[model samples]
Target: MYRSRPGATIKAIATDLGVNPETLRNWIRAAGAGHGRGRTEGAPAVPGSSVEADLAAARKRIRDLEEERDILRKAARYFATETGW
Candidate 1:
């Protein structure tokens, strides 16, 4: 009901319900329906969506490096065997 009335403030709703504004704000925030409303004043910012992208890139790099290392090791072993070193 509160969500449908987009222009209604928490304070107004609280006053109408005879409840505290802060309490109503808490309810709205807990419901995740007050992201843009109420005192978002002190909430910490949500973290890196880019972190997943970075992690994926890092994983790909690691896999590539491991493959390169294995190839180099095999080459070194092959040359060692051929040269009797």
Candidate 2:
């Protein structure tokens, strides 16, 4: 969704959508997910508090970043071994 775009701000998207910024923020917070989202086992997520789903998303992001770092490391080593001379 457009909301996930880089550098996208709440106020900007809300303006584009013809909605109040606070409302948009609430919608975003509400969408943090809950017991039925990606979590398989955890406490029942409260409506206003989506800690579980957010944690899951953060953990997945960490894994993705780690993978990207590994790829970059390999690329760096490959380029380092190549001599311009």
- In model 2, residue pairs whose N, Cα or C atoms come closer than 3 Å (at least 3 residues apart or on different chains), thus clashing, are none
Where does model 2 exceed 4 Å of error?
Answer: 1-49
Q: In candidate 2, where is summed lDDT lowest over 10 consecutive residues?
A: 32-41
Question: What TM-score, to 2 decimals, does candidate 1 have?
Answer: 0.47
RMSD to native, candidate 2: 13.5
Runs in model 1 lying further than 4 Å from the true structure: 1-44
lDDT tens readout by residue for model 2, 1-85: 3334657677888898999988877766665532222323453435435677888899999999999999999888888888532
lDDT of 2 at 21: 87
Local distance difference test, per candidate?
0.78, 0.68
lDDT at residue 71 of model 1 (Cα atoms): 100
List per-candidate RMSD values in Å: 9.4, 13.5
Query: Can you write out model 1's per-residue Cα lDDT over 6-51, one digit (the tens) per residue?
Result: 7988888999999999998877766566766433454433335567
